[model samples]
Target chain A: MSAAASSRSGARFWTWLSVLVLAVLCLVWIYPFLWLVSASFKDPLEIFSKGLSLVPNALRWDNYVRAWATAGFSTYMLNTVLVTVGTVLLVIFHTSLTGYVLGRYNFIGRKLVIGVLVATFIIPAGFAIIPIVDLTKTLGLLNNRWGIILALAGSGHAASILLYAGFFSQLPKELEEAAVVDGAGFFTIFGRIMLPLAGPVTATVAVLTFLAAWNSFLIPLVLTFGAPGQRTLAVGMLAFVGTNETDWPGMAAAATLSLVPVIVFFFFVQRFFVEGVAGAIKA
Target chain B: MSLSHSAIRPSIRRRLWADRWIYLFLLPTVVLVASYTIWPMFASIWFSLLDWNGFERAGRFIAFGNYAEIFADRLFWNAFANTVIFVVVAVPIRVGLALLLAVVLNAGLPFSRSFRTAIFLPVVTTAAILGVVMRFVLDPASGPVNEVLLQLHLITQPINFLGRAGLSLYTAIGVWVWKWLGITLIYWMAALQTIPADLYDAARIDGAGRWQRFRYITVPLLTPFTIIITLITVVEATNVFDLMLTLTNGGPFFSSEVIDIFVYRQAFAANIPRLGYASAAALLFGVCVMAVIAAQIVVVARLRRRVAEQ
Candidate 1:
């Protein structure tokens, strides 16, 4: 009984030790973000002077004022919202329709389409940016917000489509058959019955797509090069750093502005994000 | 044969007619994917063959010349080498750390969920923004890292984490691992969830210790997921263009340049944008990535089949 008690105590000791270690690691993990927020509140001199201290000597609201007004973060925020919302809607529309059909039907070219989709997965879309840029320019969509939205959304979200297909495939076909018997057309059934049933999958896709579009950097950078007004928050932060290289506090403020919303959004929808990633891997 | 053909033809036509709506539903996806993904893939090959600047509508076709030039370029090799190093160094560290963390987090410890949220908060933050913030955080002069080091008397002088040529890539890799460790942790946690608790219980009942149970059962069961998580981490490590670009911009004598940055610089950032050469580099790198992916797929399939057999 004494030996058993000792072993249990040892186990408890190890468990608490791990918890302590994890708590410290968690602080270190979030330190950069915390530091950024801290610096955002500090004056430029104090920011460098306060070294490693998370608390500011004084709360300087001018950094935010500068970031919002002078650095054009307000506009960037709006552009990010527009692009993210548009991309999310477009992706849902595309993936749902494609996934619904692929999941339900055995059409003539079904195998061929699936094959093409799978093959494209091997080609990382980052490498194809040059041609995409050229193509977008050719289509007269370059330097346009709609162009950014389209390019962001138009990339074949094969995983998302596959996710929807996996979800839709498992659903009872009797629902569709019954809908058809009740004089429902394909679009009607898809819009009303099928889509409504795919609320979880749609939420997953939306959360994933929203995060991607919101935080995407390179495409928006290149696409909005000449059109500064169209720059997303990610790209604008780079541009902000470029111009305000010496304004560390303001830069931190701008970084905080760009990051806080997305972080908050993640906190709210992280359950879906976690599940979506898990679901995609399983699929 | 003639009668069979006639009978089949009519049914095929009827089936096609019935599936017209399905085809219509597929139209927008087809158009978008073809325009952006499929066409551009072929276009990269076509563009790689031309002696073109990005400004030109058409350039003189110089078949394989760009490929030959890329093969000869020293900078191309530098970027390629750096990318390989980044992938080689980053994937193992990221995957290994994530697995360990996942095991710890999956232990059902108190406040495990909160720890996960804290760790995952960075993953949701913009890499570009983090890149910008890290510069200040790691600044050799009056930065927090240097201040901490100085206070601890760890070094006589502050180390330039991003400025030094030898240290920049590794610093970037470290930061990359920090930002992305959460996703891999999640992958591992998900994988660990698949293991039945009864197996552990059975092992414990059969006089198994914790380490022995882990070694005998958990590790074996986790083999498939490890391969998958490793591959995913490898792919993700390769695609750190945004973070790398924002952080170092492949600076301090191009010490930190990855292949993506190399292509981006040549195609977009250079004084005279070399579209053809950049396309060649991209194509070459794309082929390598594809090969690595293909090899992983084959290995995974074979391993999975073996495990199934066992």
Candidate 2:
């Protein structure tokens, strides 16, 4: 009895210790975000004046407006929104069709198509930069929004297929069979039946694609080389920082500005984001 | 019945003609992939043969010469070497830390949900933003990181984390780990959730200690997630460029130059670009990546199969 009671106490002790450690971990993770928010409020002089000042001497809201004007962030924001929206539209259309076909239909080269698509995921985009440039130039897509849209769409095929395949495989084939029995063709069946059932996964694909297109840096940098006006928010912000010679206040403000769209985007759609990543993990 | 079937043949032809809608559905994807990925992939292979400087209208088709030059170039080798080092040092540390954190988080601690969210917020933010934000936070002089370290008496002076040759790789690794840890944690957390609670209860009833239950039960169950995360980490680490570009710009002396950065520099850095040489280097790098991925897939698949058999 005595030994059992001691062990029970030990368990309680460890549980409390675990909680303490976890609290500390959480603090560490939150520190950077807090620091970012705090630094954005500080002026240029106070930013580097003291080491690790948690409170700024005064708040500066104009920095946000100034960073926007100086970096031409409004243009970048417009460009990013265009590219992201375009990528999402293309992804939905392409994945729904291809994923539907690959998922349900029995076709020749089905396995090969799936395998090849998955294989491309491992193909590094950097190595293909020169060739991509050449192809884009030939297609007259360089520094063009269409170029960004196309590249994002092409690279997204594998992930979209993977996700859609998983979801579609779980879908009841009886729906399609019944639709066929009712004299509905492939188009009607896919449009009326499958697409509706794909709501969750479609949302997942949209969120993922939007995030990828929004956060994309290198591709836009390469494609929009020498044309600063064509740059996305990410690339524009990067150039802003690099060009300004470690201008901490301006850079912090710019960084914070760059995060606003994504943070807002994710927060609104966070339900789908969580579900998508969670489902991916389970798979 | 026979007469009706005979009349249906023409109907079948009309229906088949209308089924061209499938072709319409497939057209956009095929056209885009062909123009961007398929065409560029092949063009890259072809361009590897020509010694085309950026200014040139055309260049001599010196077959295999670029590949030869890549094999002979020391800077190419240095970049390759740095890539290997980054992958070797970063992936394991990042994955290991993630797993450890996941296990701890899974053991039923307070504020676990909020903690997970905090860790994952970084993963959602743009890496471009992270590149600049991290530079400020990790600044050697006025950076919060060093200030904390100094206060703790961990070091007498602020260390040149990104400037020192030996430490530069580690600094990049730290940033990479921060960006990636949340993803791994998510995977492991998912894996842990799949584990049956009764197993741990049984282990407790059998007088097994906490570490024993974790080792015998949690670790084995986590193998699949670990393998997948490791493979993803390897691919991600090998492809790291933006952070390296933004944080250290691949270095004070190319200390942080990975293969991707090297490829970027070769292709577009100079006034006269070396597209052909960059192509060869990229191909070589691709080969290395493919080989590693292939090995990982085979080994992990076999292990999974063996576990299933048990």
* Best of the candidates, lDDT: 1
What is candidate 2's lDDT per residue for A128-242, written digit by digit as tens?
Answer: 6677777777788988999878888876477787677767778876786788789987789878988899998898888888888899888888899878999998888778876
Task: Give candidate 1 regions above 4 Å deviation.
Answer: B1-14, B303-310
Cα lDDT of model 1 by residue, B5-37, tens digit: 243455777777767888888998899899889
Model 2: per-residue Cα lDDT over B1-310, one tens digit each: 1111344445545644544554566667667666666666787788889898866756679999999888898888989999999989998898888888888888777777778877887888888778778877887888888888988999999987877876787898888888878878887888889999999999999999889998999988877777877888888888778788888778868878888888888887877788887888888888888888888888888977998899
Q: Scored by CA lDDT, what does every candidate get?
A: 0.88, 0.80
Q: What's the TM-score of each model vs. the native?
A: 0.96, 0.92
lDDT of 2 at B304: 73
lDDT (tens digit, per residue) of candidate 1 on A51-155: 577888889999999999999999999999999999999999999999988987777999998998888777787667988899879889888888888888888
Model 2: residues with Cα > 4 Å off, grouped in runs: A169-188, B1-19, B301-310
Model 2 residue B134 CA deviation (Å) reads: 1.4
